[model samples]
Target: MKGIIFSEFLNLVEDTFGLEICQKMLDENQSDGVYTSVGTYDHRDLVKLIVTLSQLTGVDAEELQRVYGKSIFIRLYQSMPGLQGQAHSTFEFVKSVEEYIHIEVKKLYQNANPPKFTFVSEKKAQLIMDYHSARCMSHVCFGLLQGCADHFNEQMDIDMQPLDDDGTEVRFTLNII
Candidate 1:
């Protein structure tokens, strides 16, 4: 496996399972340094990293398999919506290469007491709307339609509407609930 492929697989895992899981995997794989190293890591390293971390973390191997399998299907769908083809899925091949590193964050503070975790209030929808409105203007001016729409929808959960049939500039109003 190549470095690019490994990075992509990590991204897919992060997108599907969330950053915490991927971050933990990186930590466990001593290869955490690979992230900083100038392109020394590759896809084979990534596969090994995930598998070793999964084993250490007690996250079922089967669960990781299901997630990776589904990701492959989604990628295929996006790349070739109507076309069908048979290919050897590199899904697992990418999961088998890195050595796991397991650093317990709490141990870092064993001498000093760990701080208590607390929940913070989430920003209101109206605030999110205001932020997007400002962002949308910048994106439109820069001709980044997809980026603008993605940010708008993510922050406000509202689809952008084209200002005209030209499909150049668009607008979205957040519905506060």
Candidate 2:
């Protein structure tokens, strides 16, 4: 059994669900000033916590299962409606994660040599598409522009133009930051 800090577990839970839900769960599940332990920090307990977090957050179980592969973080975030909307497209979800990481890294190295990160290469783009198809099964292409924005640290705005028949053209513009 790995001796993980309680704060780390809480961070995972908060990442999955927002802070509000995490607090609520803690309040509801706390028994005599201690939250129930799963004995060992295995997959089973993670799954249960995901379910509970999902219930608290109002996310669909099927959707969470599809994207996160029983990941506690994914399950908890998938449970929340707001966060689930954020995960509408796999591209967008991945982009969000990448963006969060990039922002943090940039902040950490603002005064030093800020390592320049490359945009998602063609190979990575294809992999992301494949993963989206396998996990999200969503027809909507989201996050491609957002990912680029994060890579370049630029603001982006997506404009949807309706095309003839039943298609739409999405135009992404990099706004001056």
Candidate 3:
């Protein structure tokens, strides 16, 4: 994972919770709490932070991940003005994730491992997106989809179905409402 993710997560924690909670989480986490935007760290370190935040705030880890995903989406969208210009709708934006955004991510972070997405179907008002990744962060993907809807000012209904026992594979059904 990139350090910017960690930095943003810390920012989210501090903004949502408080400075003390964020500092306590950092103190409890194994990492030294120093992150540069260009650096890379273990993805598990982020998992730990989210889990710790969940424990402290009494929020579900999955929900936290979803909210974190939304935060990430907002940040990414703001930083990449070209992406904004290229995508006119939420569906168009999400469909470009695998081929476009991930490529850009790889260019920026050579070691970054991004999830794979396949569109099962694309209709006039609905899209089915299949997600595959070893990290099992489908909720984050869900949040990203929600963020897309928000960005496009569209009302969307999303349903997630796990393809396997583990969350490494998921099918997301999105409907514009």
Please name the candidate that would achieve the greatest TM-score relative to the true structure.
3
lDDT of 2: 0.39
Query: CA lDDT of each candidate?
Result: 0.38, 0.39, 0.88
Report how far residue 114 has shifted in candidate 1, in Å.
Answer: 48
* lDDT tens readout by residue for model 3, 104-133: 999977888999999899999999989999
Q: Which clashing pairs does model 2 show?
A: 16-76, 16-77, 59-79
**Hey, what RMSD does candidate 2 come out at?**
14.0
Best by lDDT: 3
CA shift of 79, model 2, Å: 26
Q: For all the candidates, what are their Cα RMSDs to the real structure?
A: 20.1, 14.0, 1.2
TM-score of each: 0.33, 0.28, 0.95
Residue-by-residue lDDT tens digits, candidate 2, 19-121: 7777776666541223333222333343454466668878764444423422333333433344445544434544554455446534644532211223323
| Deviation from native of the Cα of residue 21 in model 1, angstroms | 2.8
Where's the lowest-lDDT run of ten residues in candidate 3?
Answer: 76-85
